[model samples]
Target: MDPQTVYEKLGGSSDSEFPTLHSEVARTEGETPYLRHPGVILIAKPDVDIEGLRPFLEGYGEELNFDAYLDDPTPLPPGSLLLKTAGQTCYASFGPKRTYNENAQRYFDNLSSSGHGSVFEHAVFSFFVYGVSRAITHEVVRHRAGTAFSQLSQRFVSGKVLRFVERPEYQDVPTLHKRFEQRIDFLAREYDEVAEELVELQLQGDPRLVAEARTDMRKRVQQSARSVLPNEAETTMVLSANVRAWRHMIEMRTDQHAEREIRDLYFRIFLCLRLLEPMLFGDYDIESFADGTYGATTDWRKI
Candidate 1:
């Protein structure tokens, strides 16, 4: 889906007086320029099919029974259920002595404490991450394992309405903020002018080209013109990662020493995950620092 649609899906407001790259307007100072903060929407998650798992549990052995868990009125969250099931399958631990509904949290707690993170790979979550700077996405894509990313391509997408992310450090200082805004406004104008020139240049070469060919030519020109865009340019991506990968990213990105922008981004991500599956992300202890940014720590570091 397009970035605008994803941003709106993330609960970002569509109405803004200033121009925005997407539907969300994180911050708007005046009528001319606006700034945006990174946004994340959990679009997809794991869903456990108890009936599908029923056959496997039945075939495992007669000594173990998962009837109670299967029939429990309240079930574990899908990710938690999938992880617990995977963990139990490894040891055939399905029995009345340890039940899912009553003991899922404890089971996951042991998994975290004991560093059994492989089962976490069984549960995956997908998010549409937007309103972030390209710099932040550069760092995000570094997490290559057990993760998938589909990011917006400056090559194919026009930069006609470029939006920028103002650094947290610059926001409080009036001079710095004004300078940053001026730079962004200048860059936006330059990008538009350059793109128009390139488009004209292409048309001059072959004005008779068909509609499809014109589209291709426009993409080519945009690709070249986008080089003028700064690292602070807002971008969008769809990131899908397993629970283990998410934990690893959260632990690393939300550290005190991490870059403030990305740290804030991941902390927001952590909040989303915590709300979705507390059993999965409850170990994190989040705190706000003096700079008004947040950091998170977990005793279960690598798990």
Candidate 2:
């Protein structure tokens, strides 16, 4: 087929790259949506914790004189300095010999391009993400290295407020969208019914339990009923990752072949990092799509 005909057939632009297609594909019920969606917040990042560093550095010497001179007129941010210092410590590469003005930028640029990603481990970031489906977190928790996660517990929280993620595919289909909403509401109502039945059973066993341990019994009942929760249930999580881990995640998850929800998520993360530490993440060439999505290639050939 002609390139234009092929592009039209694929349902995307001529410039866009498409995921590999196959026949008889194994499909999951809760695969991520394939559209631009937003639900990431950069809650915290490394700041100049000068006071915190003072005590540790005192062990080296009482009067340690060190200075940095860079060709870039703009002074480096504290986060950049922190990354450089952490990397330099590994080689005992302090002083003008190793971190000279002439070689300073070159050193960091080379470090990133040469795949010495360990240096980035020193810088960490935290985010608060909500309004995402459980399916998204399932994929996120798989990246266990140099990261930590704390997510909302379905067992403890009451499933009364049943808000769920709406996938992009159904945006234009009002009937389907309404059906999805109704299904969620129905499930939540059923969950409440089951919890009430459990509570009544408990009360029958111990007449005074409802009056004396109302909260405990309710929580127990909800925990049991939580098994029925659907994958579309919205959840929240606080995710923390070091710079190295973030880079790895972005490289792997923001590709054309990655699940759309995760790709959308890490793309937001990439933007956040770029805003906070431009020197470190600015080299990445992130592309903005007409559909309001963002993505990038792992090839750091520019650096």
Candidate 3:
């Protein structure tokens, strides 16, 4: 998720928004704020276990055999899990609780039968996402059902030159390739020079003046600097999505052609959840849209 997404997730301002609670959701109906879905959701702290997550991160780096199921419908690796959001408001206008609540109820009941349902709602995750454009943040902020986010802000910060996204097919043709690279390179170098000069001066000045110069430089440089950033330069966001919102994120972001970066991020998040909370996760599925949606088009909005 990007900063814009964060801005959007926090939706309508309120004291209630920050101290998010399940009970408050009942009052949110049409009154829900327009905040963006947080890029990363952090759960209520005391319940978390750092040790449980280590294995999930580690497993991502391991190699897997894809040849065995090359021609068939194969599921993701076992350690991978679901981040279901069948009722998220942003991705889809879940008709109402009457429809989605039943799914949630059943899913939890199934888990309860195994004696693990109570902890299901307590489930949480920190999703680290990358490679999304500011443009997409518009849609991501809508899954406000249950989650928290931390994203990169452009308002108070400036980027390190702009990096635009380039597709593989376009790069294969020299005509389009050279122009794109040159444009990106020129802006990158220009931004570095200006920001560096400003930083060096601030380092040598009095504290107050240093602050002033830093501010001035950041503003001035960003004025022209951001012009070079490409829509696809990678952005990293962290989200604290609960079991419910996870399902929603998967429904939307995990679909074909969700930005490759977000798709990759959602996949990682799904896999992580699958490992620690299997009983709660087993009911949801990610394989539904894993194949070709994104590869088929340039329209990332579909994700």
TM-score of each: 0.85, 0.74, 0.47
Report, for every candidate in turn, its global Cα lDDT versus the true structure. 0.75, 0.64, 0.43
Model 1 alpha-carbon miss at residue 205, Å: 1.5
In what order do the candidates fall by lDDT, top score first? Answer: 1, 2, 3
Query: Candidate 3 — what's its lDDT?
Result: 0.43
Residue-level lDDT of model 2, residues 1-303, one tens digit each, is 122332233232233221111111111233222222445666677775434544454555534422222222445655677787678778755434666533546767788889887787888888777666788889999999899999988876885454566665554687977676666667766777887777788768755334456667666777788887787777778889987788788888777777776776777666666656666775667665655455765565322
Candidate 3 residues 1-303, lDDT tens each? 222222233332224212221101111122211111223322332132223434443444434321221122323221121212221322432222322322544644444455532233444655554445565555566567667766666534765423344443344588876665565566556656766765666567734324455576566545544555555443445667656566567656766757654554454455445444544444444343443222111121211
| Per-prediction CA RMSD (Å) | 6.5, 9.8, 18.7
| Deviation (Å) of 119 in candidate 2 | 0.9
Which segments of model 3 are wrong by more than 4 Å?
1-121, 155-180, 193-213, 257-261, 286-303
The sequence of per-residue lDDT tens digits that candidate 1 reaches over residues 154-248 is 88777645677887788789999888877787887788899888777776775532136756777778888998988988887898999999999
Better of 2 and 3 by lDDT: 2
For lDDT, candidate 1 versus 3, the one ahead is: 1
